[model samples]
Target chain A: MCAAASSPPAANPDRKSNAGATPDPWEACARLEYGGDRSPAWSVREELLATPPEGWPAAETRLLKSLARADATAAGRAFLCQMLALVGSAQSVPALAALLKDVDAVESARYALEAIPGAEASAALREGIAAVSGSAKAGMIGSIAIRGDTSARYLLAGIKGNPSEPAIVREAAGRALEHLATAKA
Target chain B: MPTASTVTRRRFLQQSGVATAVAAAPLILPSGLRGAGAPSRKITVGIVGAGNISDSHFGPLLGDPENVRILAVCDVDRERRDDAAARVNRTYGNQDCKAYGDFRELNRRSDIDTVFVCTPDHWHALVAIDAMRNGKDVYVEKPLTLTIQEGRALVATARKYHRVAQHGTQHRSMKRFHDVAEFVRNQGLGRLDRIECFIPPNNRHVGATWKPEPVPAGLDWDMWLGPAPWRPYTSLGCHYNFRFISDSAYGQVTNWGAHYLDIGQWALDMDASGPVEVEGRGEFPSSGLFTNATKVDFTVRYANGVPMFCRTRFEGGGTVRFVGERGWLDIARNRMSASHNDLLREMQAPGKKIQLPLSNNHHENFFACVRSRQRPIADVELGHRTTTVCNLGQIAMVLGRKLRWDPAKEEFVGDAMANRLRGRAMRSPWALI
Candidate 1:
């Protein structure tokens, strides 16, 4: 039986203190176990979002680094990706796209990338489709279609026609292409 | 010479062809009786989602056995689908009804003419869109899609397939709601000032932490979570309780507000369009598995400057109250009230009666439209527009700021953060489009 999944949980007991004024706690929150207390992290998130537009770069820097931590839980990464989806820019795309390689983290990675509007976001999805396989690849195809990345038209066509690709992936590619065509029409 | 404030009954009737009289005669007779096709030809139906809501649809549909045939029932839960199919079989005194673990199998049956999508919000778009693509008309429950993008896709698919898509925002079919909408549309309220919709909060609650249990014997947990983010099964997170969770549903805002807010759009005569600005505050369970708003206070302003205020009130069921310069009228299930006792009587001094599309029975309306090939009382586009209002308020609550919206483009103005919340990426192998 799989363990129950709930909202993201709390602060990390093993978090190492950084030397600075108002040290960033996002890393600590990102290290918390699945279903741990996330209130402290949510407070920090609120504070970060409440900050003016100029304060986003620093917050994005902290969040992106936390997302890259090998020790961070997949649950934590998913939560961070959600925050980044709201506040992230093109700079956050590569890290997000990289996380698409992690099986557990792939959904959240594509979720964040799907929302961040830019040619780069779609490009990351197109690249992620080639890098990942199975459901992850199919999901990335969906993200590209949602982003309306016409540039991926050839890529999708190739996957859809490839007999080697899994049926699910090929069907997803076909559906994405159909959806994009309908969108164009 | 009547100004905007002084809305004459004749002028109102001229501008909008909706009825303003107080009589309930229009609802007493089912519209299906008049327009329903030949009794010999039955409209075969396959209902997806055999939980509590399925009973509401199947019961009435089964009652019209001569005109409607229950061919199949589908659900991810084995017990529920089997029970629903058994019930249908029992009603017919035969073993003809088939139980399906997956809706796709049922949708593939070329004989089934229409589908009733009573699935959860997250599954609404995927199921309905698939059914339409397979050449089936659909009657989908309220808060049509989980996201604006999904709603757009569903509408496009419906148009492409030429399916008779009826939204289950049944208030549009009820007599009291119709009267209220007609009253407002005919300016019986005298230059509409604002609309107020009161909705209830989440009916169920969950604790801060939960341990996932083993998947139940008869339930397919993965299939149930279709298109939603993968999560381990908690006994409390499945079935009816899915409404409380953010991943699976949008809580009371979409649950109850979808019905009430829909009436506001109808009364405002903005069925094809939506609000231009929205802002709100919400109270969510900060730590619980349930992530949707428990209480929400949001106001959506139309381009015409009529603001529809939706608030969560713990009592009095739910109502859509339209306030105007002259008076106010509030309508709920089986009842309606106005600022003055004689308001209905005064409005009865009608020149030419303004009659809106009349639908007394929502399910029957769907079946009638299935045969007539006309747009139902609650069309998919109207559902999308209403659901858009609910989602905009929800997004505004989440962002905690006022945002500009372009109803035509169906996107937030210069706000990527808000736009991000408009649609979520569906989980793999279940492409939303």
Candidate 2:
């Protein structure tokens, strides 16, 4: 559909005759688009997409990849979430929110939740709390308390330092609990 | 009807006669027309806009020795103005050239014979009118005026003041563009049916939000805004970002659309006329920084059965494509391609002529007319007509309705609501006259 609308002008001998008379080649090119069959639309899009991946900023590349797979499967969504987290795009919060309940992508969702900044990130954290289980939920609550506003105090109070948890997760929860306690005082 | 050979011979003879007469009479006419010997003195030229387009105009004007001398420069920002002036002075070795923070101060100088009004759309008319009133000719950037009424006034004022005003629609100066237009019109390219103009999208506005900030020091924010309604400063409201808003500028339609569409109109030989009807659909920002249409497809129909299609996001930057009964031609700034290699070869061949009273210099075209007392290549009427198409597209987007325009009367046909949009209410102390 996009290609047809942007198809280059139909080739004609007369247009060439006219353009050939032009003294400057650049001006001829400017006129050829209106007078020729070449679709500038297709060329512009092709050029943009052809730009090297390394040439694009990390955030732009992540956004492009996410948009490319926005309608893909749960695993695809998980991969996108992981990529978004790595780039630290606040733009990833909405994507993470949409994926929070997809059971296969819960761990990726947790990473996205941790990566989002400020209030929106805390909301994603709250949503992740109900969908994930055990240590993941505890970790999300600790992340929420650290990143969220005053409204997150109640979530902070629910974090219990279980011995079975990884040492780093336990330490993060302990620190969040201490911070929440200090805030209350 | 006269045969093609007879018409061509007659035109050549007429032009030759005029050229010979002009050479013989070396007198300056009252309407500020200069004959061949009017004066070889170089006129000093000043540049008003020191933004992205400074290089485009600066290089061409500085390179042409017959027309002008690099004199002074001005920008709202002192640093840019100084830098532009320094560059010109260094290149031309004219050490006494001055830099101005205010265009009004630059206009006060008697030594400056012409002013390049390359500022933003909002400032084009204001500076051009002021420059003319100050007895200086003007070469304004394209889309000539910000509003329909302003365009009309600029054209009228230029004539009334005997000032030579050239809108910077430089494609008119290109031989190839004239050939394309002539070929299409002459039936060498078959029947002209459809013309499409494209402006590609850039990422400057993607996921962007607008927040007002204090006007920075070393900038006159109000003057920069000019005739645009008073508003708090935002990064998006000035410089390269100004086109994204309706209040400050007309977005891409007039930004790049003006140039491409000007070429389209020129090719169609509609320099003194425009579409009778115009309509469009596009996505405008619902909130945050941008208010201009992000994506749009607009169609304008001329009285002569020609349709102009202008679209955004078909590619990037801007391009114009013409579709004729026999074939088509595609043109952008840097490239030209045709389906038939023969056509490209033929277009490049010599002896196939399209003449435009050739002047390799835009500023020279204006100065020659300043002396000749004749219209420049991109004359006011031509500028108004081309700019009207752009303004019509903008109005269609703003009103979100199909508008019927009377090219002869230069007004909306029985549509009072649309007609009202033909001009804007100028802010006080900045009168249109």
Candidate 3:
């Protein structure tokens, strides 16, 4: 059977209580399965991409609200993040910034923030350097380096010098610094 | 299609310091001293990703002109790497081949002069770039990279290091492909109008959804994922099956497309550049372990007004046909057909022809270039450009729209979303730069 055909509805039970308002487009995302039927979510993404500049706030708001729902599944939120990476603006930064500290959500957050563009996203990644450690911290450092945010050089240098940081994280910071230096060259 | 600048073989060797001793010699070396059996002439190699593709490389490297050495084999799977190491040692009648779970360890070895990056698509750029940066020539498997951005990075790295890099488009080494490419280049078929590339359907059998399975013994699942985003282990997603998954591979589009599209690019003489406009649509597995497109129909229009159409179907024996105003020439593995037999006949005359460099064996060609410091037949720049064609088709398929591409800038024209798709953020601690 088609994987999308067998998927269950979005797990948020409260989402259906609003009968009169425009149907929540993302209600089906919470139960979206990877490597399975994603047409339902893809359709919503197409809608989001087609949104005009003036309507981006509404679309971003809806996705953020769905992402914050207590019952929203991790897979569902990741899907939302994929959409936000495309149409999202500065308004979506804070919600995504919070995800930088989430072990489960940080990867998804990085996926979005890395593509969102602009200074806000770069700042969130810079600040995120302190909020996580180990692999999470190492990953955020990699993202910052890819952005070529020269402002993070001092921050990365400090991490490279600190003895308390794990060797992997320290090595990652050192490598990231080298990458930024090469970019400047 | 940012083509490589014309660097003559003699100039390349001079710049690379390969012929410095000869240039400084009072006279040419005595004939006896110029023997080909010198141990100093050996090209030491390390094979990364000892998976299925490694089989094709081993046969040539192990039984060669007696100068190529397999010093090490690396794979995330312990069993595979150990088996490859054992095979190499057995062939050499010694226990010298090292096995490693991390390619970085292999890349760091100064003794290794070249690396065979046979890893899955996602790991290609990271492994190959690291090898080049460490002064090792590389033979990266076809498709070149998982993303367009990775291919560009690889080309830049090779030029920066002056490393002799070859892409694993072995068809170019075969006489048949070389003949057809030369014929088309010489306009044997008349005015080139269109090129059609027929790809076979996705052959792997996979269900709509996949469930996580136990990490098997001797397999480092995390290492296998490498730069790709983290995911649970599943037998269906590892080994050869990785090609069917979206994260690790781009299905048959890259798996088969890379081979056929490579020939098309060579025939069209567009190795340094590519189509300015592209559009396509494809059918992806709606919900299954196989997320790559199952049905692909895409077209890219070159600046010369010729359009190359790539489509998936069971017919055509999965061939690439160069169509011209007068006739067409079709080519595939051990398969060839032409509108007129006279064209093929005339190509055999071979005098005053736009002949491409010939290498009956791909591995031997790479080793030759490693010592000679000349670009291989399928250099990294050509590999990147061919891969760019595949990646552009994929991006167009996913976006379901036409995209205007700037080959020089290597970006989509005025399309931020499309440009963003050129590359993805490497899963942390694995930056390509």
Candidate 4:
């Protein structure tokens, strides 16, 4: 599938959520996976989202559960990850962390994890250090770098020194290493 | 439409230290709309860069049948250029739209009334200046120019020629952002204190070494390196990936900062003047094919004691926030919000809400200005000023010290090193000057 069609709701939300008293983010998101015609489902997600961010606990719990689902598409997962990237926290890490091995969602998952401030997101990326390979591996390493996670020095150093790994990943490791060092300075 | 004032243009050119500009021919209104009564036709366009970003523009322009007539496509990459031209021809159901390996050929065509400079940031100055000098209105991509000198020259030259050059910072045309900027500008936030800019760096997938790959077929490697230092062919060093390489551009500092910082400046009403001092920390790679600042925590301070913190996206998370005594307002591409709900609710409390000149579509706004001769939402000079903040921020990060800036003069106060960094020695056979 092309990148753009991978998920419709990520780019255009209103297409899914009909204008109402409250627009839903999840229903807007679910309309991506299920269909825009599933108006009632997205309405709940939107209604929950309308509870103001301070009252988003119910909304947050539902999103985390959706993220935790194993049946999620990379595009579907990325849509969720993008939303969470804005408001997610330590509690959102485990569900997102489980996807680091996901060849498709790794980038989006890492992006969400990267933005969620704290030791947990960094810890999640560092822990996924061994599980991911290819672009997923490279992406996680870079995300860890963007997070300025110095704790990954050992992991990054190993990748930087690895001869057999692809140049892209090794270069990313090297760059991430420099980032960690400079951030410390 | 603001008429091209010849006397003022000459004086401004002299003041800008441009010895001479291309003596542009008299303005020719698009044949479609001339005299008092002519059937309006599509504004003729020559798309100058056929990369992925340029492709994004195709859909919108093609969708708006009223505005687009892509007369030609040009790129250093032959295959890409032909592909773009083919798309245009396909959309128009004709093979009349031509393709060129050089942008100059595109600029030379009198039939084309407007030009879109969608090349790499480094190529922005040259392509836009060439179009302006040739008397074609331009819609160039952001960060508008790669250097301070390029920016100053572009602003002066655009005026000297009286071309409607829209700097490609799209958010300026978006209603949500215009709302936030107008709010902060009109003091809805009460006594604007400081603006905090948070932009993340980008990592284009170029490998770590200078190991050159063979030049790809149908690609003019030297032409692609136009005005930038020449190096052996690397796929990553070309196309959209070139943003990560500092020699060609200032990386994400301009790439993303152009969006976020432009919002910051727009809200602060600081497009005409910028931060008096810039300082902060940035981390560059010691050895890599890509060398833009990977880590930055820059602080740009305005003359009014309002200090803006330019930090990693993690700090405030890829948005621009205006903080003031009453409250704060935040703007991101996805969201625009205030610190308190009541502030946003009570925004229209009579003379409280400021309404900026309106624009909701980026491409249409440019086309409209081209027809009207009025400045677009993101005019060349305004775009230059916003980009100047980004360029100066990157310069400060690279130098690792606070440097004084003379925004009025568009120069560094006294730092010799910083002054030199304003412009680069373009590779021979390609010149912006």
Assess the local accuracy of residue B330 in candidate 4 as a C-alpha lDDT between 0 and 100.
80
> How well is each residue in A149-182 modelled by candidate 1, as lDDT tens digits?
8888899999999999999899889998987886
- Say which prediction, candidate 3 or candidate 4, comes out ahead on lDDT: 3
The better-scoring model by lDDT among 2 and 4 is 4
Q: Top TM-score: which candidate number?
A: 1
Clashing residue pairs, candidate 4? Answer: A24-A46, A27-A42
> Against the true structure, what is each candidate's TM-score?
0.88, 0.63, 0.87, 0.64
Q: Quote the B-chain TM-score, candidate 1.
A: 0.90
lDDT of 3 by residue, A1-185 (tens): 00132343222222122212224548766566544455556557656644555787798888888888877667787888878887777888999999988887888888889878889999999998778888778888888888888999999999999999999899889978987987752
Where does model 4 exceed 4 Å of error?
Answer: A1-185, B1-39, B204-207, B314-317, B348-354
Per-prediction DockQ: 0.24, 0.01, 0.23, 0.01
lDDT of 2 by residue, A1-185 (tens): 01122343222222122112224322122222111222221222222222333433454444434434535444344334433443434556666666656655555565555544457767776766667555455545555543434576565444444556555455545555654554433
lDDT of each candidate versus the true structure = 0.78, 0.63, 0.78, 0.70
B229-295 in candidate 1: lDDT tens per residue? 7777887778888888878778889988999999999888888999888877766565556777767
lDDT digits (tens) for residues A64-166 of candidate 4: 7766665655445655765566557788888778777665566667766766768998899899878877656776776677566777898889988989988
What is the lDDT, from 0 to 100, of the residue A147 in candidate 1?
79
Q: Each candidate: how many clashes?
A: 10, 34, 8, 2
